[model samples]
Target: MYDNYAKVIVKGSPITKSNFKLFNVNGRAILPMNSGKYHDRYAIYEEEIAFNARSQNPSKVLDEALIAVLKVYYKSEKRHPDTNNITKSIFDGIEKSGLIINDAQIRRLIIEEFYDKENPRFELELFGESSFSMDYSIKPREILEEKITYNPPSNKKKALNDRMNISAIKPKISDNICEVCGKGTCKENLISANKGKTLICRTCFKKLF
Candidate 1:
């Protein structure tokens, strides 16, 4: 679930970073330059991508971690470009459009390829990472009931049953023991650590420091 999301479709034949021409300077060193036919094609492609992203009208540049899903369609099956190159182009375009502060903010990326003879383009989706949440609370009874109702003779069902059994018997940290040393201790003497997820005795705490 994402609070900030945007979808943009960029129509064009995707290009890769490998297309940048390399030049030799006095035969001393090689440098990559964004000049020539490849540069022209990539410039147009990036421009189109920026236009599509701007059409969505993002209020401000997003600086938070983001997830990007890219679907690339090629005009012909014979033409195959490196997915990483296309992804780089898309990210630069999105940044240029002021949709995101920088491409480095993208933490997760998914790319899928397909052939579309009629229309070749890139379908892009961006999601803010702040919207992601993790739920650790478990209800064994509810989970068991759901599993039993589905009752598929699969390994997944077996795994779920095992997990339920483990959860049911798992001891609480308030069991009057030092989890680190596996020794009995008074509950009051046990200090909470790791945001109360773990309980350790004062002796262990001193040793740790």
Candidate 2:
């Protein structure tokens, strides 16, 4: 059933894994988060796991509903909507719902899905190595605070200075390497404007064209 949804998303148009694209993590399936940050905006697809209204009819009704929702998604995103008998109405829920994703993948998907730079301007920090800054942009603030704590008074001032220092600068996204080739470039090198993770440089990018 779920495969059906993936099928719709993959087969709706002339696009496929090679040409078709969807915002996804390097090693994960499913689009990360298109729900946006708005409180009320959301996807209307419904994937029902259990039902009591009659099995056969329910599945058919669900298929129709899912198809209708996918139609809306395809039109808005200009990409195909993947739906199947097993596809849920909405992938994630509120609070923790609506596109369950980690910080690294979320940032990667964000740059891939939204960043409007004509030329890909930046990349996300995927690897946290010694002597380098942590992926502060996508890394949750709560986690950071927990790891580094300062005493009050003099230490407090030192902490503020350090924290401000990190926030003041633009992030270097050379952290997230390309899963395909394992060699990642700085943010200025990526090209995600088209769609999906089908990333490539200008030279390689033209070859596809």
Model 1 gets an lDDT of 0.75
Each model's Cα RMSD: 15.6, 26.5
Off by over 4 Å in 1: 1-3, 21-37, 58-60, 133-209
Query: Candidate 1: minimum summed lDDT over ten consecutive residues — where?
Result: 142-151
Candidate 2 local Cα displacement, residue 50, angstroms? 80
Pick the TM-score winner. Answer: 1
lDDT for each candidate structure: 0.75, 0.31
Pairs clashing within candidate 1:
none
lDDT of 1 by residue, 40-133 (tens): 6666667777888988755656778888888999987665676777787789879989988899988888788888888888888878778753
lDDT tens string, model 2, 1-209?
A: 33222111211111122212244456553432354432112222212111211232233211111211222122223323332311232222111221223222221111122222233211111211222232324544644443534344675889888888987775555664544455666656656644656555554556657
Error of 2 at 18 (Å): 65
TM-score (C-alpha) between model 2 and the true structure: 0.18
